[model samples]
Target: MVLKRVRANFKRFIKSNAKGQTTTEYILILFVVVMVALKFRGLMKEKITSQMDTLGTKIEQITNDSE
Candidate 1:
């Protein structure tokens, strides 16, 4: 009957669209991860630079003391 045919088509449409929805969700998650990584990168760079500077100062002091 016509009702059965309509139901069948609706089911097919939903099945096809599910993949697209899942792909969109994955893309959104990936975007969020990339954004967070970029934000942290700057903070990490600053901390590394500060640590290296501190280490260099200590080494210099030690050298001066030795001489």
Candidate 2:
């Protein structure tokens, strides 16, 4: 009887703990995505700034030509 009770409790414990595996997987995926984003953020910002600067220069040239 004691062995049976222990086995039942072990089953319950296993069932209750099963969700942690999925939660851990999701957290790991989220962490990887955030790390990738952080790594590329500076490159993305630089590209955007360069594009804006080029656009500004073109706009200034067009305005000067018009004037």
Q: Rate the local accuracy (lDDT) of all candidates.
A: 0.90, 0.90
> Candidate 2 lDDT, tens digit per residue, 15-48?
7887865776798999999999999999999999
TM-score of each: 0.48, 0.53
Clashes of 2: 0
RMSD of each: 8.8, 8.1
Worst 10-residue lDDT window, candidate 1: 7-16
Per-residue CA lDDT of model 1 for 1-67, tens digit only, reads 9999998886777678988668767999999999998989989899999999999999999999999
For model 2, the stretches where C-alpha displacement exceeds 4 angstroms are 1-28
The residue pairs that clash in candidate 2, if any, are: none
lDDT, candidate 2, at 63: 100
Give lDDT for model 1: 0.90
Error of 2 at 2 (Å): 25
